[model samples]
Target: MILFQLSHAAEPIQVDDGYTVSKRFEKYRKLDTTISLPKLSFTEGQLVEFDLRYAQVGQRELHLDLFHAVPNKPSKGLIIFIHGGGWRAGNKSHFYPLANLLAQQGYNVALPEYRLSIAALYPAAVDDIEQATQWLLNHSSELGISTSPLIIGGGSSGGHLATLIGFKNNKQAHLLTDKPIPLYNAVINLDGLLDVTSELALKFENRKGNDSALAKWLGGRYETIPDLWHQVSPVNYINEDAPELLIISSGQARFTAGKDKTKRLFNENGRTITIIEHENIIHTFWLFEPYLTNLAADIAEFLMDVSKIEQE
Candidate 1:
C-alpha cells in the first residue's frame, strides 16, 4: 500500500476566507488519507486494474484507478471520472463502487487523481486532468480502450474541473498553451458551479467562513485574479460545437453565475441537454443511498445513447 501522507501546510495562508489551508487539510485527513477500498466484490466478470501513474506533479506522482468491462471485450469508450471535495479534498479510490457498476455495464472508467487546491492552485488540477486523459489515450490500445470517444464526469467540485477541461483547446492550460484534447462525446456535471464571474462569488460574501473553497482554489478572490476565475469557468467557453451534456442537479445553476448561459447555449445549438433534478433533496444528494442506483442508471442510459456505447 502506497501511503500518501496528506498533511496541512505549515502556517498556511487563510486568505480572506475564514478557513485556513491547514484546517481544510485537517478536515480531509479526518475523513481518510487514502482511497476507500472496494467493500463489495465484483461477480459480473468486471476487472479492476489499480495504481497506474498517469502524470506527475514535481515529486508527487498522480495515478489512476481503472475499471473495465468483461475481460477481452473492447469497450465502446473510456471515461475519466474526477472526485469532488470542494476542490480541496477527495480521492479517486472512493469511486470504485460506482466504477464497478459502470464497468459491469461495458464502459471503461478511469478515476484520475489531480492536484488538490491544498497542493496547488487553480489550473494545476486542470492541467493534471488534461494530462491524465492524454496518458489514457496514449495507452488505450494496450489497455483495450477505444479512442474514438471519451466521457468525462464528476460530482460537485470535481464536476467543475470535468466541465472546465472540455472547453476549447488552450482555454485552460496552466502553461497557457494547450495540447490537443479529444473531442468529448458527452460532458457530465453533478451540481458543478460553471461560472465564477457572479458578484455573489466575486463580491457579496465575506472573505471568510465556510464558503472558502472557491477562493482557496483560485489563490484569491475573483476580483484579485479575475482572469483565473474567467479561465476556470466552463460557461465562458460554450459554443455550437460543444458536446451533449448530462446535468444532474438540485438547482446548482441558480447559484452559480453563467450556468444559465451554458444551458442556453446547449439549447440554442440543439445539443442534447438532459437534466435530472431530485426535488427537496440536498445538493450532491446523488452521492447518498436511495439516489445512487437511479443516478447510476441515468448516467448509463445517457452515455449509451450519446456515444452509442452498449450495456452487456
Candidate 2:
C-alpha cells in the first residue's frame, strides 16, 4: 500500500525566519508574517484582503486566502497560488508570506488549500482547486480583480496541480462548477512532476526502494494502479489549448524526467515552453526568497508583460 511520509519529517523546515538575514526586513517581515488574521487595512481604491469558503455548502469546509493590491494606476492582473506538499500536507496560512510579498507588488493573490489525496483522491483535490478558481471568478467584482489574464502558479506538487488546472480542458465531474472554470492565461510550474506513470515505471525498474516520492503520494505502488498513473498525469492531457507554460526545475533526478515529458508535450503541440533552470535548489526551495528572489522578480515581470495586453 502506498503511504504518505512527511518529507521534512519531525521538525518543520525554518524558512525566511528574518533573523538569518544580513539585514532584517522589518516592514516586509511584519507585512509578510503569517498571522491568524492579516492586519493590513486599505481603502476601496487601494489593496483589499479577505478569505472565502469556496467549497459547496454542507460539503467539506475549504477556505481560500486572497490578497488584492489596487494599482495606483488601473490594475494589472490577478494571480492564484497553490502550495505543494505532495498533495498530503501544507496549509495556506503558512504560505501567506509569498502572497503578501506579491500583493505588496501590485498583483492580487489567492492561496487555497484543497483536500489532500490522503484525505481524498484523484479528482477530489483537483475539484477543490477548480472550485476555488470558479469562486474567484464569480466574486471578481467584489474582490476588485479582473477575470481576464488571470495567472496561476505554485511550487512542487502545487506546481503539478496548477499545471493540471491550466492544461486539462475537460475537467472531471468532481470539480463541478455551474459553468466551466476560466482557463489560466499563463502557468508557473516550479519543480512539479508531469507524468507519474513513466516516472514510477522507471523508478520501479531501478528498484530505488519504496522511497518513491509519488508512490507515497498515491498511497501505494504505481505498478498496482497503472491506469491511475496515466489518468492523473498532466502530460497525458496537453493540447493546443494548454496555456502558456513556464517551468522551473533544479535538474534533480525526479524533476528532469518531468521536464523531458513537458518538453515533449510542448514540442508535439508546437507550443513554446520556457524553463528557468536553477543552479542547485531542491524540490520546493523556490518558495524561499534570496534563492526565490530572482525567480519571483522574473515572475512579477512576466505577469506584468502579459497584463499589458489586457490592462484597464
Candidate 3:
C-alpha cells in the first residue's frame, strides 16, 4: 500500500471544537458497546492520493484527498464527501475511513477540506465545496471517473453544505470565480440539519447565545440574521430542479428539522427521496464501525439505484 502525506511543518494543535473522533467515541461507547472506531488500513487495490490543492483563498490553500482503485474503473460516479464540525470543527481525515471503504467498493471518493468558521464565515465553506466539485468535474477523465452521476454527500454540518450545494446551484457573491456552480445528480445527507431556522434548531443554536457553533458560522443569532438563517437552510431550496436525495438519520429529530417538508416537496415534484433511519444511535454514527459499514453499504446501494435510473 502507498501513502502520500500532506506537506506541512509540525501540525498545529487542534482547537477544542468539542467535535473529534476520540470524544465522540468516548461519549457513544457507553450507549452502544458494538460501536468501534474504524481502523485506517488501505486495501491492496486501493489508491490513496492525499492533499491535492483544489483552490486558494488568499494565503490559505484548500486541499482534498482522492481515493479510488489501483486500476480505476468507474462504477457509479464520483462522490465528494464533506466533513462536519458544526461548520467550525472537523477535518477531511474524519471521513477517511468512509472514503476508503467507498473507494474499495468501486466508487471514486473525494474528501475536500474547506475553510472553517474559525477562518471564514457562512458562504466560505459552501463556496469551497462548490469549487471542489468543479475541480473534480474538470479532472474527471484523468482521474478515471464519470461525472454523469456525480454525488454530493456529508455528515452533520457537511451534510447540510452538500444538500445546500445541490439545491442552491448558484454562484455565491463570496466565490472568487464567475464560473457557474457545479450541479450534482444526487445528495446523501447523514444526520445534517435541513432547516437551521426551525424552532428546534433555533432552540439549540440560540440556547448558548451568540456562542453556539451555528451562530458563529452564520455570523449572528437567528434574531439578528433571520435572512441568513433561512438562506443557509437546505429545506428552503427544495424545488423541481433539486436532485435526488437520500437522508440517513440517527434518530435525532433536531438534526432532521424540515425533513418532512423536504420529502413532501420532493414528492410533489415526483423526485426520489430515500430515507434510512437508525434508531437509538448517536449523531456521528457514520464515523464508527457497524454503523459506518452500514452507512457505506446503504450509500453504495443508493448510488447504484440512481445510476440505473439515469441509464434507463
Instruction: Give the winner by lDDT.
Output: 3
The true-versus-predicted C-alpha distance at residue 284 of model 2, in Å, is 2.3
Better of 1 and 3 by lDDT: 3
TM-score rank order: 3, 1, 2
Model 1: lDDT of residue 110: 92
Cα-based TM-score, every candidate = 0.79, 0.75, 0.90
Model 3 agreement with the true structure over 1-312: per-residue lDDT tens digits: 122333452333234356789988998998889899898777666778899889977656789999874355546568899999889888899999998888788778899999888768889998899888889888878877666677889999999999988878722322435655566778999999998888888888877979988889989998988999899998887776677899999998988777988899889977889999878588899889988888888998888777333411
Candidate 2 residue-wise lDDT, 1-312, digit = tens:
234333423423222122212122343345444312223335455554555778742434677888776566445567888887657666666456666666667777889878775566567778888888889888889776866677788877788788877777433322556656566677888777777667544574336434454565555566676776667688887776566778878766565356777788788987667777876544455445554556667777766655323312
lDDT of 3: 0.82
Best-performing candidate as measured by TM-score: 3
Task: Give the alpha carbon lDDT tens digit for every residue of 1-312 in model 1.
Answer: 122343422323222222233444455444434312224458656678888888755557778988877564556677788888778776776566677777766788899988777768878888888888889988988987665557888877888788877655423333343455566767888877777676555443236633568887888876577787787778877776566688888653443445667778878876677877656354544444345566778898887678433311
Q: What local lDDT score does residue 236 receive in model 3, on the 0 to 100 scale?
A: 82
| Residue 53 lDDT in candidate 3 | 87
9 Cα displacement, candidate 2 (Å): 26
- Give the runs in model 2 whose Cα sits over 4 Å from its true position: 1-50, 56-59, 170-178, 200-213, 216-219, 305-312
